[model samples]
Target: MTAVIDKKKCNGCGLCALYCPLDVIYMEDGIGHVVYPDECWHCGACRQECAKGAVRFEFGAMMLAV
Candidate 1:
């Protein structure tokens, strides 16, 4: 899984970065970015903490299969 931040919806609150348990998200130029997608635990903490609802998770095709 990977976290994708929508720039239009993001308000640069940095909450997503702060809430990421694995430190996968980072703040740059007042915007939250997924710097380490490979390290993501798919815990959804960042998405839950984002007040603007700018953070979203994208699962690979392989991951979608049960």
Candidate 2:
């Protein structure tokens, strides 16, 4: 799954970058961006931690159940 960030909703909190287990997310010009999408574990930690709901999943909703 890909973690997509909405620049409109993103407040540049950097939480997604900080909390990502794989250390894939990073802040670029105060915007959250994924650096290593192929390593994503779909753990939903980024989505869950984003208070503004800026981070989202492109697929694998069922994997979140586990």
Residue pairs with backbone atoms closer than 3 Å in model 1 (clashes): none
Worst 10-residue lDDT window, candidate 1: 57-66
Tens digits of per-residue lDDT for model 2 on 5-41? Answer: 8999999999998899999898989889888887888
Report residue 22 deviation for candidate 1 (angstroms). 0.8
Q: Please provide, for model 1 over 1-66, each residue's C-alpha lDDT reduced to its tens digit, 9 standing for 90 to 100.
A: 788999889989988888888999889988988988889988989899988989888987778995
In candidate 2, which residue ranges exceed 4 Å CA deviation?
60-66
Alpha-carbon TM-score of each model against the true structure: 0.86, 0.83
Taking every candidate in turn, the Cα RMSD to the unseen true structure, in Å, is 1.8, 4.4
Per-candidate clash tally: 0, 0
Where does model 1 exceed 4 Å of error? 61-66
Show the lowest summed lDDT stretch of 10 residues, model 2: 57-66
**What Cα-based lDDT does every candidate model obtain?**
0.88, 0.88
